[model samples]
Target: MDRPEKLLTTAQAAEHLGISRGTLARYARDGLLKPTLKLPTGHLRWSLEDLRRQMRELREQGGE
Candidate 1:
């Protein structure tokens, strides 16, 4: 079986989600989404699957 894709950086996650990097940071602050990991450099990363799930949930909730 193919291995799952690795976690993505804030920029990659933002682009994949079709949102701005600041928006992603805002979401993180608002507790709408959480990072999968925090690097030693203090950068945040997220799993593609988790990002997708958050998008779906937002859509279902009528995007607030």
Candidate 2:
């Protein structure tokens, strides 16, 4: 059996990325970062791996 990928809430994702929650939301809205899931309560969740990948890509591109 395989373990499921870790999922992060918006705030958690923002903190992990060292960014403000609003900035994270803006990134999602702008399509810079996409949410892995949306709950019925309208909350967004992101994959930890995906976030890390995006951070690496941003670092490589010289984006802060």
Candidate 3:
């Protein structure tokens, strides 16, 4: 089986993606991004690979 991917907090994710936290949240709200996990307490988490995938998609469309 594959190992589980590392998950990132919102701040870490935003920094990793070179965007501000508000931009990350806006991307989520605008349907441009989705969290890899949404906790029961409503906190968000992201997989590094998923974030990379989203960036690739956005770049393909010139949305980045």
Candidate 4:
């Protein structure tokens, strides 16, 4: 069976993506990356799978 997806807070997601929190927020604003969840307190969360997929796509497109 497949494992459940891991959820990451904005800071953790940014760190995993090798980017700053501000940049991650910009990407979300630009629709480059969508948050998996937004808590009632207004915090963003991202799925590890989604981040990994984006990284793979970026690599395929010759982006760092």
Candidate achieving the largest TM-score:
3
Instruction: Give the higher-TM-score candidate: 1 or 4.
Output: 1
lDDT of 3 by residue, 1-64 (tens): 9988789988899999888988988888788888899899977899978888987998899895
Candidate 2 lDDT over 1-64, as tens digits, reads 9999889999998898788999988877887777899899989999978888887887798876
Could you give candidate 4's per-residue lDDT for residues 1-64 as a string of tens digits? 9988889998999998788999888877777777899889989999978877876786798865
TM-score for candidate 1, residues paired by index: 0.78
> Which consecutive 10 residues in model 2 have the weakest lDDT in total?
55-64
> TM-score of the candidate numbered 2?
0.77
Look at candidate 1 and tell me the lDDT of residue 45. 92
lDDT of 2: 0.86
Candidate numbers sorted by lDDT from highest down? 3, 1, 2, 4
lDDT of each: 0.87, 0.86, 0.87, 0.83
Off by over 4 Å in 3: none
Candidate 2 deviation (Cα RMSD): 1.8
lDDT of 3: 0.87
Q: Which structure is stronger by TM-score: 1 or 3?
A: 3
Predicted structure with the largest lDDT when compared to the true one: 3
Query: Ten consecutive residues with minimal summed lDDT in candidate 3?
Result: 25-34
